[model samples]
Target: MILNNPSRKEIKNVLDHAKTIAVIGLSPNPSRTSYIVSESMQRAGYRIIPVNPRADTVLGEKSYASLSDIPEKVDIVNVFRRSEFLEGIADEFIKIDCPVFWTQLNVVDENVFNRLADVGYTVIMDRCIKVEHAILK
Candidate 1:
């Protein structure tokens, strides 16, 4: 199946309408891109759910051990894990039914992309949400 990757316009719409973002694999280190990006989104008034088993908290919010652990609905699932581990994350993502499944820059898996697309998810691979948000907002 040909996956419908979000166009720039579609991405903009998604970013514009999204209220909460679940950042999978968010690191506690302030220098990490995930940390910085999530912080920026939070400052912009988007609720950021930091998902990282190793981290207890980030950006002053309690970190969820996994996507399944998040209590509230997540509009976007921004993945920070490597390509090798994406399938597992995708598995978790499918169970939760997030509208957006975004794989961070340089992370891609064709099989997972196909799977997510088949399920009607708007998948964005190898794109930085922070950069997109800066440009779109």
Candidate 2:
């Protein structure tokens, strides 16, 4: 089954209300695409929680090994991981009960999205959160 993302208005609402984002698979290296997008979003005034096991910190923010390790509430779980790893990430999302689930462009799995939606979580796959933010303006 194919997955359909929310409308632009819904995306805009998520962007407007979400203040803190837990970025899973975020890399410390500036050259990486994850780092670029995450950094751009951070600069746009969103508090970014870097979730990378291999890095102690990224973009001046302390990084956690996983979303389960984040101590505070996170508005969105932005994933930059490959499609094959999404099921595991989805499990973490289920545990955290985050309001929104987003994956970077060209990454998606309909089954994972269906599971998130089953739990009433807003799912956004194959979309760039940073681009959506810019468009909302």
Candidate 3:
């Protein structure tokens, strides 16, 4: 079966209860969309954990090489990677304790979505977390 994004209310609930967000593929460059959006989220009171192998840090938080490298608990696994990378990222995501898997705007993969959704994961795709937070919160 195909997958669909959760309702706005459900998405809002996830954001409402979430605190720490691990941003995969987040760039250290401030001009990058990943960096810009993440910085905004950080300023909005959410803890931003950068998961970029190339960056030492982003938004002043230590950057992990991968999601599994993060030591602390993460409420959301927000991905800024392209569509082709979602499957690989999803593979790593299930191994961690995070509950929500969010893909930035224009990023979506039906196969990845179905696989994660089949296992009862909360998956949000093709939507910007920062945009959702601004509209819902």
Tens digits of lDDT, candidate 2, 1-137: 46788999999999999999999999999999999999999999999999999999999999999898999999999999999999999987888858999999888899999888887889999999988999896
- Per-residue lDDT value at 76 in model 1: 95
The global C-alpha lDDT for each of the candidates, from Candidate 1 onward, is 0.89, 0.92, 0.93
lDDT string, candidate 3, 1-137, tens digits: 34599999999999999999999999998899999999999999999999999989888899999999999999999999989999899999999998899999888899999899889989999899999999997
Q: On a 0 to 1 TM-score scale, where does candidate 1 land against the true structure? A: 0.94
RMSD of each: 1.9, 0.9, 1.3
- C-alpha lDDT of residue 126 in model 2: 94
- Candidate 3, residue 52: the lDDT equals 94
Candidate 2 has an lDDT of 0.92
**TM-scores, in order shown?**
0.94, 0.97, 0.97
